[model samples]
Target: MAVKTIDDTENYTIEWDEEIGAIVFTWDKYVSGATFREGCEALLDAIKRRDAAKVLTDTRGINAHDAEDQQWMQTEWMPRALDVGLEYSAVVHPDSVISEMDVESILEGMEHSGAEPLVTSDMAEAREWTAEK
Candidate 1:
């Protein structure tokens, strides 16, 4: 599918890749609600189109975005993702404050919602973890 961009005050992009499944926040920027929602939507779309696919959220700018938004995503969006068929094997990003969240909170949210995310530092690790074992 073609890359979709949402101008929700925050800058972000979403795309569906046959290989990666879902690619969210394909920029070197911070995370935001707009980005998270777009991602949640993209995951849902991927689930509908494809099967349970991994997600890659380029989080190079996690520090640049509002912390509350990130927390909200962790609390709210993650659960929503699980409700769908989105099984997120990993989250690609560098070490940042965002990584400090309780894995249980994130996983519980994902489990309650539909995704099972394995947060990582980059695409390589995320891909490796998500790859069918």
Candidate 2:
């Protein structure tokens, strides 16, 4: 299995995990504004180039999202991702209650369209869910 690092920054790391066959987003304690958008664009580029169908987001290290970023994720980023063939998604919930709520809201909005992500507290569970797809 070939694991490729697509994007690595102080805020996050996005990579292709060949074992699970998914693009993984490993976030830091806090990410917002331009950095968050850039990371999302990086993922989108990888998805297009690799023809990826799955994504696993590890939010365990992250805190809350800015309202604007959350809105951009639900409105702009997600649709673009789906258009580029992103199918299944799994998100490992953040430890903080505030961040968990933020992530959940985004997932709930996405449920109405596109791939509804599997949100879990356990990374193993999230990995398994994405790998199965």
Candidate 3:
């Protein structure tokens, strides 16, 4: 699989994985507000630019999310992502229980968006699940 870097920042990196035909978001530590929103938008643009439907989000390094950011993600970003043909997502959860719970809460609100989402602690599992047709 060819991995092309789309956007790289201190907080996160978004890439296009050609082999699996998925946009991958690899996060680093805590990110919030504008940084978080920008990263999400960049991921959406990557999906549209590559004409991809699946996404793999590696949140292993992330430790927390702002409440406002989480709300924005579920209410704003998610719908736009789905509108742009994001059909499936695999999230590699962070080790922090609080962060994991936050991720779960965000995912819960997205359940009705018609996208299949898999949450796991293992990167291999996430990759495998995201690549599925």
Order by TM-score, highest first? 3, 2, 1
lDDT of 2 at 97: 70
Model 3 spans > 4 angstroms off: none
Across 1-133, the per-residue lDDT of candidate 2 in tens digits comes to 7889987888788899999999998886576899788877887898898899998988888767888998898888888888888888888876667766888877666666657678778888888888888
TM for every model, in the order presented, reads 0.60, 0.90, 0.92
Superposing all C-alpha atoms, what RMSD in Å does each candidate have to the true structure? 4.7, 1.6, 1.4
Q: Candidate 3 — which pairs collide?
A: none
Q: Which ten residues in a row have the lowest lDDT in candidate 2?
A: 107-116
Candidate 2 clash total?
0
Model 1 spans with C-alpha error above 4 angstroms: 1-10, 22-28, 31-52, 96-115
Q: Write the per-residue lDDT of candidate 3 for residues 1-133, one digit (tens) a residue.
A: 6999988888889988877778889887677899788888888888888888899999888766789998888888888888888889888887667867888877775668777888787898888777774
State the displacement of the C-alpha of residue 28, model 1, in Å, after optimal TM-score superposition: 4.1
Clashing pairs in 1: 30-61, 79-113, 82-113, 82-114, 82-115, 83-113, 83-114
Model 2: CA > 4 A from native: none
lDDT of 2: 0.83
Error of 1 at 112 (Å): 7.1
On TM-score, the stronger of 1 and 2 is 2
- Model 2 TM-score is 0.90
